[model samples]
Structure formats: structure tokens, C-alpha cells
Target chain A: MNMTTRVSRLRGDRVTLAHGGGGRAMRDLIEEVFTDVFRPPGREDQARLTSEALQEAGAQLAFTTDGYVVTPVEFPGGDIGKLAVCGTVNDLAVGGARPLWLSASFIIEEGCEIALLRRIAATMAAEAEAAGVRIVTGDTKVVEKGGCDTLFVTTSGVGAIPPGRDIAAVNIRPGDVAIVNGVLGDHGATILAARGDLALSTPIESDCAALGHLMEDVIAAAPGMRAARDLTRGGLASALNEMAAEAGVTVELSDEALPIRPEVRGMCEILGLDPLYLANEGRAVLFVPEAQAEAALAAMRARPEGEGAAVVGRAVTAGRIPVVTKTAFGGTRIVDMLVGEQLPRIC
Target chain B: MNMTTRVSRLRGDRVTLAHGGGGRAMRDLIEEVFTDVFRPPGREDQARLTSEALQEAGAQLAFTTDGYVVTPVEFPGGDIGKLAVCGTVNDLAVGGARPLWLSASFIIEEGCEIALLRRIAATMAAEAEAAGVRIVTGDTKVVEKGGCDTLFVTTSGVGAIPPGRDIAAVNIRPGDVAIVNGVLGDHGATILAARGDLALSTPIESDCAALGHLMEDVIAAAPGMRAARDLTRGGLASALNEMAAEAGVTVELSDEALPIRPEVRGMCEILGLDPLYLANEGRAVLFVPEAQAEAALAAMRARPEGEGAAVVGRAVTAGRIPVVTKTAFGGTRIVDMLVGEQLPRIC
Candidate 1:
């Protein structure tokens, strides 16, 4: 098939089993799909690995692993392949680890066209390169039809954490400022839109990207920052709740200061889903001493990934639970850690 | 509720959402149904953090992770909890790693009774202890009902490989002998029976157990062994195929030498499933050099876990494909990796 013909056919729908197999169909899927999306960056930025092992080792190493079982594998903005790599690299960066080597394992349903599997692998390899991570080892297994959806990816990453750095959500103290790297709920909303169940209108695409460089700058600006965690499965609200629970202190998020894109807010309102409980594939919440909040915010703004970075809340000793403001009415309310998945099959 | 009354209510039934919530209902379900059936020594075998870390760094480390979504959470012989711990640990052990710490993450459907969640966790903790492994960290999340079944478990394990030992399937030579640690297909058969289809009447329970000590013995006895792998989701047939493909050799087996419980064989026949393709959570396969095969077999025989160890096959260089089995009818045929899952959600 001609390049244009293949590209047209590939972009028209959700991913099928053929997208993962290692064959010709796989190649077309990668070139027409991932390569066109996650191209190399045009900026220079510092990267760090942030897991406990790297934090204590006084060395730079990136370590991350993520599983993806997103239904309708291909979505409006991305697919499982892109999410898997970005997810791992982002974890490494937020943990002060440098994005490095990655290993991917695929559990493909049987009769999945080999061409499709290859495409996903190729797309994954390309995304790894975009995020500056290398694909080193891989495994593939075929499950009988109905054993799984189309495919599931499990990725493990190894990166080097920089020296002389310590960061953890548990380190936050009363008066520490909570700075979000960027806007919220874009990914969750974008995915919901692609599902077409809500029948909502408005442009929304997943905010999926690597944040290693953004973290490096903020850490450099405020080396003594209290903590950092990627606001993922639980979103900003859930992330704050976990920090509060772990640190044994209440966290108060300012609704007025929180950053939510207009499109995301509109969708959340219409869908009856709280943006606070939504998910994000590429965003982080950092706790910094109030004095350094401005410097940290400025540092975040200086990076490509942190253009929308802003101070949204503060850690407190009162309340004994996570609390947030109702942006519309200025009403105070509980920002509970997501007890159950509002949407399962999310990354 | 009285023990008899509660027991009668739970036997051979479907799991409800309330069973997974972390509440009073969750507690009762665990205590009444699961704990009553799969209680480990002191009920400590379930997955629970034992300490800050597990084991001192020594030899190499073997690590593996598995996600379980087996249908019918509660089975006749074992359940998802027991299978999750034992399966991952077995993978590490067969790879020459002394299993150490385990990390568990659970996804519970909303409204799942808390009692069921506790039971699964308790079962996991007890099983972990039985295998001499510690669960160091865990995370739990709830998903909307129908987003997943009642529950799903993802377990990751770390184990230390003994020093001065090298085992890789590629090391297998033309004359290397292949021995199985125990009987096959009990676990798969029991799961099939639990499905209540085909009017199957097998009383076979899963043969799931941790096989670390057994591996240590074999490694010590046959220092020059080629490689080892536990037969799990894809059964001995697929594992041997992977080894053959990786090592660039062919494996030949005799039907007469393979170990299978009569119940398991009968179940396989009735269900139209091949025992070779069915999973075995408790068993392992060792490829030893011809000169050390006898020693390896003797060592395996001494271990309680390996009491049924038997030499079932040999590796040959002349064959192109990885697997071949001689039938009871005196004919040889290719035994390929299963095309798809024979028993979905097996491990």
C-alpha cells in the first residue's frame, strides 16, 4: 500500500490486534502513527530519577514501570504505546531519575495480526527515543482470544538519579506550597471524549508528555523542596490526599488557584465527573517551602513541560483531611483520595 | 452469622461488589470464606509488609511481576490471591533467584464488599510467608463497577540469585536432560472444574506452591545445569518452546515419562484441552547437562516440593523447532507454544 493509503486507514479508528504483531502491518502503524506525534524536543533541559533507591544512592538512575490496558487501544490523542513509555519516563523524572533504558512486555491476544503488534513496538521504540530512553529488552506472549483485550503492555525502566537530592511527598510540612506543573484533567477528558459516550463537544486532547527536564529545573531552583509526585491515577486531589496521609498532616488546595483548562472544566461539568478525581498521564505536584514557592514556580515556567506551572495550595496541620475549594462558589469541601477508580482500565 | 450458615451461603457462588470494599462486609467475607479454606501457617502466608526491606544483597536478583484477573475469584482448590504470590515467586526461583520481597497492588470494583478484599489480602500475605517471601509495599484502588471484575491483583517480586551460578536456557546442549519438578495440570484442571462447564467432575485442586528451596537444591547438585523455568500461564509446553527458541535447540519429550495426575488427565480429556498446554503454578522444569542429569534428579527427589521430579525429555541440536513429543501411539509430533490462552486468567 502507498504511504498515504496506509496512513489514512491507520488513523481512522481504534487499535486492533494487528497493530502489535511484528510484521509489515506493524511498520505502517508505527510510521503513520507514533513517529508523527512524539518527535524530538527543541530545548536543552536537565533530567533526574526520583525513586527511593536513586534518592539514597546519591547517583542518577531512572527506574519506572507501568501497565496499560486502555480500552479501544487507540484513542483520539494517543494509544497504549505512547502512554506506556511516557508514563515510565515521567515517573523516573519526578523521582529525580534520568530517563534511560526501558523494557517492554506484551501480552497480545491470539490471532492479533502480527503486523499490528510490530507497529505498536515500533511506535514504542520511537517514543522511547523521543523521551531519550532506550528499549533494551522485550518479551511477547500470545493469549487466546478473549483472554485479554487486544493487548496489554508492561514496561520497566532503569534511569540514574542525580546526586545530592532528596524529595518525597512525605517530606512536606505545614506552610509548604503545592505547585502543579501544568493544567489538569486534559488526559482524562480527552479519553472520555474519544469514547463518545458523553456526546460532548469541545476540543480536548491528552496532556501526555515527558517531564524529566521540568523537574530538573524546579529541583535546581529549590533543592530543599519538600516533595514531588506525579499526579496520575488519582489526579491532583488524590495525590494531595496521599501526601497528607503519608505525612500525617492535612493538605489544603486553593480552588481559585488551581489550573484547569476551560475545555476540561466544561467537560467535567457536563459529564458529572470531578476534575479532581480525573487522571493525568503527564503532570506533577511539588511541595515547596512558601518562601521558595515563587522561585519554584518561576523555575517551572522556565521549562517547556511546565509552561502552565502555578501554586495551587498549601500543606497544613489543621483539618486532618485533604480539603479543596469549590471554584464556582468559593465553598470549602473535602478532596478525598480516590477510593476507587472513577474510570478503570486507565493507565 | 453461625459458621455453618455463613459457610453454606458462600460455597460455589458468584462474588459481589461488596466483597471488595475495605469495610466490615469485606472482613466477614475474608474470615468466613477464604481464611477458612486457604489459611497459611499462622495465617501469615498472605501478602503483608514484613519489614522496611527484605534480604541482603548477595548473588544476582531475579524479579518478575504478574497480573491476575481469573474468572470466579474463588476456586475449588485456590483463588487469585494464592496464585498471584506463588506464580511470581516461582518465576524468580526457577530463574535462580532466592525470592525475597513482593509488592502487591489491587484494583477493586466499587461496592465490592470489604470482607472479600481482606480475605484476598490475608490469603496473599499467608501465601507470601509460606514461600518465605515478604510483601514490602502495597497499593489499593477502586474502579467503577463493570470496569473490571470484582478484583484484579498485580504482584511484583524480587529475589536474589545465588552467587557463582549461571543458568540460561541457551546453555542447553544437544544431550541435556529435561526434568519436571512435579505433576502437571492440577491447577489448570481445578480452575476448569470451578467454571462448572462440561459437567467436569475432577476433585483436583491447583498444585500451586513456591519452589525456591527446590531450585537451590538442584542448582547446588548440578552446578552446570543449563536453565530453569516454572511452568505457569502457558504450561510446560510453551515454556519449553521459549527455551528452545532462545537457546536455538529442539526439545524432545516422551508421553510416557511426563507426570500427570489421573484426575488432571481426565479433566483435560473431558474439556478437550491438552494437558501440555494447561498451566501448573507449583511445578518447574530444569535442563541439566547430560553428565549432571542424574545428580540433578536425585537432588530434586530429596526436596518435598520436588518429590515427583521426573526426567521427561531431552534437548537435541538437530531439530529446527523447539518442541517435539512422542505420542502414546508411537508417533512424533510438533508441540508448539499455545496459540492463545487455554485457561484465561490462569495466572
Candidate 2:
């Protein structure tokens, strides 16, 4: 395979208007980069499944969507493709559903390399396979050369929940414990370094991964799990605050218990950024009953995606502040929702 | 309400970085333009219903996704928002499902006008309501000024079909009768004029309408329905050829029976373009048994979207060509898929 992970026998290295024209060229592009990698066995139109997708299997479905615009397309450890697929699958998993199907839509600029697109699709297919989900259908469109930066991908997922299961943000209980699956700020820090805006050097890699398998274990272990969330754009801080406020309680975090890599912490310190608000692609937060907290933590730590699991906080019955933190100095401070991140286009 | 429709008391006319931040500005933009127009009754945290969307009643569903990037976000009859909703809805409708829920994801440039976005959302909400579907979940992301065009919207839809229902392109039978729902080439002609690329003075309007309601009636009436397709990008020519090739039969069309608007024909004649290859936003060609063709035509013509319905073609048992036409001049001509569409971003 080439560096971009595909044999290029099509047209130019860059995408042309014909690639999106709904003709022979469009069909060939879809087949080469998308269908060849994403399709399972015994599928006629792998890229789209336009006709076969019409078949229906009876099941109650959970549907969700997310758009990934992370610049540099290629980050330290993962590219936009991995983020798009894993992100949507995790969204459905955290919603208490077994994600079964996905639809990937790509909006590519006229000048993007075909090889890069194929590599992205390969990454997405691999991630989907690992997550035990299928990219059943997809669409592709190419715009004029300067009409877009490079590419943007949107993955919308559908999943089915068991009859007795119900998961939502407002299910938080007073004595629930907050647990994080893995290290935080690695994705944000890696994207920052990849942009070369700070000119810093570090081998910090993004924690981009699909958490479906880990979530299945946690859910099975902690039968009393109240709520769960995957921290993406707004990171762990935003997630905890939303859950606390919805349940009419205050969530208190132990600053020293947060799972942060020393490298990510140093990077944040040098940049004057809070690790609490930094994004982590592969991390999730779960609210489990106090009785099941230990089991939940153990189950999370058993998986590769959750090797850095930690119990970070506790939920208080009544308080005005939605989220608060007890620092290493024996002082308490509020962790409000992030107002704005100067870094744009970071997924 | 001014020409833009709703009361706008937000910040600047053009969207800023704050509009996308996970803070007060982002919340306000979402509330004013998105939720206020899209939501049903009482709902907390109007920005996202991540958990609420998890509750689904057991039913078979059909899921699909499509992206709309037409130049001139607004055309003579519809905007990108309408196209995004209707296009995805029609895709599911053609697949023999009653469209139910949709996810709208927007990638906006930094400086696009907020009023324009609000109007577009209103249009989408209206269309979704007309199609008897709900915009249950949505997402918005902002990019740098030159990172994208004004905006790109991807709508992913999920629908359901009762047991014993099945639809596929390969279901086309040799003796099937072909039917079209609306005037051909109007959408393409209108888009060409909207771009002002040809400077034509045609008054043609795009046939951009949701066909789910019409499809329901047709499916209900035609018990022996074989297959159906919506002519969006490559138009009727591509759809007919695909069905014929899929079923290993020959499609024969009568030029005199094909429906066409006078203005659209004149415009196409002036531009040396073929109507059969032009795009249509609100058209579907169906294959039905000869005994049920009349019932299908009557059901289609009963709806506004199918007012210009016509029985334009038939499927032959065997022939070398997949699609052929008997011309008005008493001659036969081959109707092959266009190698490339001159109208690149028309849809």
C-alpha cells in the first residue's frame, strides 16, 4: 500500500468536480476509497447501500449525529476519520444503546488528495469493526477548490436499547460517584501541537478511540449506573456540570484524583489552559451508585480504552453550584462551563 | 417580523466565534434560531436532547444520509435547508419507508449571516412538518472565514416500514410500467439561472418538494409496485438506466409522453442540455405492474408534489441497450448516463 494506504489508479491526486458529479467518475471514487474499505461481505453497493438499506429489521433505535472539523486533518495519533466514527459510536453507547449501524457523509474540497480520503475511510472502517458497528450507508460531495479547507465528515449512528434500559442526564442520584474512563486533555493538547501554533515539542498522542466495548463492561457491572457521557468538544467539565444541573445537585471533584498525564498537564500549564475543559476523544464519564462504584471502576480499568480509569467526584443532594472542585490546597472552586476556546476547528 | 420572519434580538448580523462556543452566546443562537422554531413543547436544555432521544418504541427503521451544497444557498423556490431535509426524506421514502425522524448537522463559515441561517432553519422546520417528520436532533459547528462556503447541511433520516413490506431496485419486472411524478429539468434550469452562469431570462422554478406523503399514497394504492427512484443529481436518465441494468431488462421511454415545462425546455434548448439528464429535487420514477399502473398514477396525481405526474416509459423483456427512447420525430435514440454533469453544484 502507498503511504495514504490505497492504490491510486483513478484520475488526479486531488479531487475534481467529476468526483461528485453522480456519474462514472463519482461511482469509481466511491468504490475505490469508500466501498473497498468500508463494505462488508455480500454487499452490492457498499459505499451507499442505497437499495439494500431499504430492508428493515424490527428494533427500537437510538439515533445521534456529530460533525468533525478538526484542522490539520492529521493529528499526532488520530485523524478526522477515526474521530468521526468513534465519536458517533460512543455517543450512542453512552446513551444506553448497542450501536448497530452508522451513516458516514463526507464533504470534500475540490483539491483534497484521494489517497488521504482512502486512508481516512480505512481508519473509520477499522474503528467501526472494533466497535462492532457497521457503516451501512454513506454520501459524498465535493465542492469548488476554495469553497472549503479540506474535508469535513459527519457520522450519524443508530442503535437499539434493551426493553428495560433507560439512560439520561437527569438520572443522577445524590450519592452517585463520578468516574472517568481515561486520561483527559491528550486530544486537545495533541491538536494544539499539531497546529504548530505554539511551536512546542512533545510526543503526546491523542486518546482517540471507540468506547463501546468498555461501556458494555461498565454497564453490565454497575447495574445502578445513573448516567454516562463521552467528553468531546467541551470535555469533562461541561459534561459534569450539565449532569449535575439536570439532576438538581452539586458535583464535587477531587482535583488530585483527575486522570491527567504529566505531559498533558505540563502542556496545559505552559499554555495557561485548564485540563478540565480540554477535549479527550477516547474518554467517558459514568455516574454509578455508591454501592456499585468500585465494581464500575474495576470494570472500566479492565479495558484498554479505560486503563486510566479513576473515581473523580461525588454528587451532593442540594447545592447552588452545579459543579465544584476541592483543590490540593484544601480550597474549593467552581468549574463553570467553558466560555470559549481560542482554538477553533478542533473538532 | 421583518422580511426574515422571526424576531431577532441576538448579537451581530453575521455569526461570530462566540456563536459556536459552548457558552451563553452559543446557547442564545441555538435557542433563537434553532430550538424556538424546531422544538415541540416543554423541554429543558433546548440545545441537545442527547438522552431523551434514546427512548424508542420497537419498530423497524430505514436510515440514510445526504449532504446538500448547492450554489446560491437560496434558489427561486427552495433553499439549502429545504433541500437537506427533503432530499434525505425522499431517499428514505423511495426506499419504501414512512419517514419519521431526522438529524440536521450544519458546518457554517465564520461570517455567514445569522438571519439567513434562521430563515433557512425555519424553512427546514416547515418542510419537515409538511413531510410528517420531526427534526429530533441537530448540531452546529463553525469554521474560520475561508474554511468553508457560507454553509453546508447534512441531514440523516430514519424511517419505519410495517412487516411484509420490501422494496429494491432489482425488483423491476420486464413488463413494468414507468411513471414520473413531476416536470423534468425545472430544478436544473432554475439552479442554472440562480447561479447566473448562463444569464438566461427563464422564469423556471425548482421542483423542490418532499415526496414522502406522495410515496405513502402510491405504495398504499399500487399493490404490485416493483421499484422506485428519486431523480436528484443525475435525473431520470440515470435512474431508469440503473433500474434496467439492475433488473437485466431494457427501459423504453416515449419522448412525447415525458412531462416538461415550456420555460425549462426553452432554457435547456438554448444551453444545448438534455432534459433527461437534468436534476430534479421533487421527482420520483416508479415501476408498477401494468394492471396497477393506473392506480399508481391516480394516487400520485392526487398530491401536490405529483401534480405533473405522467406515465412516460416501460420495461422490455430483452434488448442490448439498458435505456432507449422513441423520439417525437419517429426515431429511436439511446439514453445513456452523462459522462459528466455541466451543472456541478446544482444540488
Candidate 3:
């Protein structure tokens, strides 16, 4: 049997602390769990390729760092390891960079199971490889309990920004079109479900994917696209407000154009949450010129990661606040930036 | 009063949820705390300058981000605010970057006093201004009371790296000179004292500061400096070991050349904690070429941040472990990376 296929079947066992103690258990976890999960597509010959060389792509490099202190390190659809790789790589992708290298620092809690730790590390390594990034350097420290929650992963990522394109929030402007790559609130809802508090269940999964290629396609199709932001922390509302405030323009997103899953919307309704302010681990908001809106949408929809890509909003000359909705009832309302946290640590 | 000083002293009677709400309170915190703290030494008049053009100093840019999950965000010598800026800026500094722009995100617990939140934000802002970086973008989210422990600040900083310099662990070689920036154990010892454990009393403050200029001087003097690392988590022992392992060489240190405050040493002796593994917030180890060792040392010593800089060791040809001596008894011991947590939540 091939390495990855054989390893994928061993995901049922619970993790132990021994897996993290740099022993045989740890090696197995890396080989069986991580290597299996992160095995790159089209790489049948695993022995020849070193883990480091697997992640490097292109010439120029982009490096960014992020720290994850999610209240519960292990959450539904993801854990700290998954979040670390996705978070760091997303930053590079949205910044028009191809992720290449990542250095992870794990602040583990005392008495943490070796298996759990190994699982997390192996997952991170595999995720990096899958995302075309290397787990280059790592530092581990075991903090006493309560000094840190079970595990916190801080990742420093280095990538290569494609030449001939510049993307920043300041590049946004009036008369630009805003598009969303996919449905929102899946990540946040999945997290809440994982908490087991609401007695709700849904076949929801996070849309976490490395967005570099999609962004590259969009930029290549419409080089004048002003800005691209990943809607992670503050969601669509927060991201729009930021762009409007930074670019000094008004943003108006259509109510019908926003692609939110029914499960996510229902949960938000029951929990008194606003999906606009909810987090999305795997999504992007693109600001492009009016003339290129169709091209941008077409480019996004061409990728498997952007099947739900749609034109959600546009920049206007009038108004200062971010507004939304020509509701089914023919009502309009302002979609203000979230004044408070809706669902915390959903990232 | 100047804008920063005026903003710094605007203490509130109490902190409200809005302070962490990402609205008016957050804006106030940014205007009052951050702007004041991070204002350049002589250019306070240009305090209102928010343009990125006014911020960039050098040619190449290096960006790094870190989240401060240190328990008891407020600690002796400095608090989470100072640590957030110093720790992140230090990372960039060691990478030979001149810090320019910083983005801050605050994850605050519900029911936290707005005043306390204000105090921390003010401290963070002041520190950033002091380090000559702009607080350009920020996010604030409030979790349920127990969701997060108090307040956590994540700062992402961007800086400019000098041309023709790419310092990495692989640059180190046998016979390279190792120099430490200052006295060790201050941050860890002070933290212990603050915890009120064992009633250990010492007047040591965290050695936290922006090391950008200090690094600039070192690189100017010895452009071929092999590698630089900040001795933070796992302290000096961990830092040394990681460097040696990365370079595939052995490291030897002179106990006499190592700097340890008397009170810290005494506390370490009593608590049975190896001060070597204790964390240091503000110190760094610089690996230099044999030919430029003296010049690098001279450059570092001339800076205020590196007043006590000294060459403490050299890379050796064999042995996987780092070794240090207790000069008093002529006993030698291996200085190993920390096996686990020394003190948790320390930035």
C-alpha cells in the first residue's frame, strides 16, 4: 500500500502525551497521521522528496507570523494545528504571495498527552506540505497548566509574492465591486457545534483552503482589482468597514448575493448572532473595478475552492458607513461593523 | 503637553465593554494609549502622521506577528502591552529588520473594566510609538467571561531588512563567536517575584526594549554576522542549543562571561530552577565571524540596549549539547533546552 492511503485509516485512535515526547510513538504519529493527511497530490514517490523542498515554490518570498490562542485548542472540523497552517498561509495568499515556509512555536501545557502533541505537530507538517509550505523550524515549551490553555501554536510563514501585482487595503477605491469567494459562517458555526452547547448538528465544515491560486487567477484576469481580504476574524461586515474606512469609500453588499449556508443562518438566528459579523476560516472578499466584476467572478468560480464565489457588494461614491440589503421585504439597513464579539475565538 | 503625553494620561474611571468592543472605546484606546506610547523621540510634532510613507525607513521589509498569552497580562517591570510590542519587534530585530508598521488585535473577556483595557492599550500604543512604528490596523473582540483569560493582544509588525543580508541558523559555523546583549534572568526572576511564590524578592525589571537600532549597529560593523536569536522561550539554554543543533556544531560557554543578577541566582539556587532555562524577554545572542567579533561587540556595547553586551561563547566542532560551567566549584554541566515549561504565559 502507498504511505498516505495506509496512514489515513489510523485516524480513529485518541492521542496520548507520549506522541509528543520525541519517541517512537511520535515518529509513528508523524508517519501515519500527518504524512497521510498532508501527502501532496501527484507525489507517489515520497522517499525522494525532502519535506523542506516540498513547500518552496516561485522566486520572491513573503513571510508572515501569527499566534493562535483559541479558548479550546481542539475544535470541531479543526484544531490548533489546522488553524495555524491555514491562518498563516491565508495571510500570504491574500497578500498575493505563494506560501513557501513556516516556523511553528508550540507552547504546550504541562501533562499534555504525547499522542495529542504528536497529532498536532504531524497535522501541522502535513497541512504545510499539502498547502505547499514547509515546516522549517520549530520550538516547543511546556508551560504549567493555566499558564496557557492545553496548546497554543504560533506560526511564522514565509512565501513568495507573485511579481507584477500589488494588493493592499489602501488600493481599494470608489466604484469598485466587492465579491465573496464562498459561503460565510461555516467555520464559526462548526466551532459552536463542537462546543456541544446548543444541541445543534449540521453537516458543516470549514472552507479553509490556501487562496493563492484563486487570487492569482483573479488578479491575472483583472489586474486592476484593488484589494483582497480574507474574512476570518471580523467577517464580511468588519472587513467591509475596514476597507471603506481605509479607502475612504462606501461599500454596499446585496442581501441576496451573500452566500450563507442554511445551517449557519439558523444557528445565528437561534443564538441572536449576525452572520455578517461571524467569522469564516475559508473565504475571501475581493474588491475589483466595475468593468472586471464578471471576469473576477468567473475566475473565482473556475477553482474548486471558489465554487460559491459571487458578487456580494460594490463600492459607491456616497455614504461613509458600510450598508447592506435590499431585503425581500424591500427594506434597507446598515450593516455596521461589529461593536462586540459575536462568536469569540472561532478562528 | 504633546499629543502622545496627553493621550497617555487620559485615564478613565472604569473600563467598559466598548473598550474592547472595536468601536468608540477601541478608537479612544488607540488615540490615547498607542499614539502616545509609540511617538518617535524627536518627531512628536508629526504625531498625526498616519501615512505609511512617513513610516518606512529602510529598503527591505521583514514582518513578524506574535500574540501575548502570558498569564496575568500585567506583570512586574512590564505588562502585556509592552511585551506584545517588544517581543514581536525583537523577533523582527533579530531577523535584522527595522520595524515600521504594526497591526494589533485585542481579544478581551466580557466584564473586563474598560479602564484596565484602556491602560493596556495605552501602554501598547506608547511602546509602539516609542519603537517608531505606526498602529495602522487593529481588531478587538470580546469573549464570554471565561472564554479567554482577561485580555490578549496580538501584534503583527512589519520592518525593513537591509540589503545583502540573510542571516539564518545555517550561517553559524565552528569557531563563530557568540555574544549576549545583556544580563539574563531578569524577566523570569521578576515574574517569579510577582507571583508571590517563595517570597522571592528582587528589583529586576524585564529587559524589554526595541533592539532594531542595536542590530543596525551590529550589522553595520560586521555585515557578515552569522546568525542572531533572541533568548526568549526556554531562555539562553534553549536558544543556544537550537542554534548549535541547527548549525550541526557544539557550543561552549564560559560561566564567568555569563551575566546573572545576584538575586536571580540566589532565587534559582533556592527554587532549584536552572536560571539558564528561565525566560529572558529582552536579551539576544549574536553569532559573529571570528574576524569581526571585536567590531560587533564594540558596536553592540555602544548602544543603550546593549550596555552589558559580552562574548560569552564560541561554536565548537563536536558534541551535540551546549556546555556551561559554575566557576565557583569548577564544575561543568550540559546546558540543554528546557524539557518542559519553566513559567507559563510569559511573553
lDDT of each: 0.68, 0.82, 0.68
State the lDDT at B254 in candidate 2.
98
Clashing pairs in 2: none
Model 1 interface DockQ: 0.09
Residue-wise C-alpha lDDT for candidate 3, range B104-197, written one tens digit per residue: 6565666667667667877777777777766654445555565457776776665555555677767888899999988987887877787776
Alpha-carbon TM-score of each model against the true structure: 0.76, 0.93, 0.75
Query: How high is the TM-score of chain A in each model?
Result: 0.80, 0.92, 0.81
**Which candidate gets the maximum DockQ versus the true structure?**
2
Residues B117-166, model 1: lDDT tens digits: 65777788788878898665443444455545666666666555555556
* lDDT, candidate 3, at A319: 76
Q: Which scores higher on DockQ, 2 or 3?
A: 2
Tens-digit lDDT track for model 1 on A172-222?
Answer: 788898889899988888777777776876587777777777877888888
Model 2 docking tier (incorrect/acceptable/medium/high): acceptable
lDDT of 3 at A220: 88
Candidate 2 lDDT, tens digit per residue, A284-313? 889999999999999988988888999999
Off by over 4 Å in 3: A1-77, A91-107, A111-114, A120-142, A152-178, A241-257, A268-274, A313-322, B1-67, B92-106, B111-141, B153-178, B219-228, B243-252, B286-297, B310-342
Tens digits of per-residue lDDT for model 3 on A172-281? 77788899999997877887787777788878877667676788788889888888778876578877777787777788778888899988898889889888877777
Please state the error at residue A238 of candidate 3 in Å.
3.9
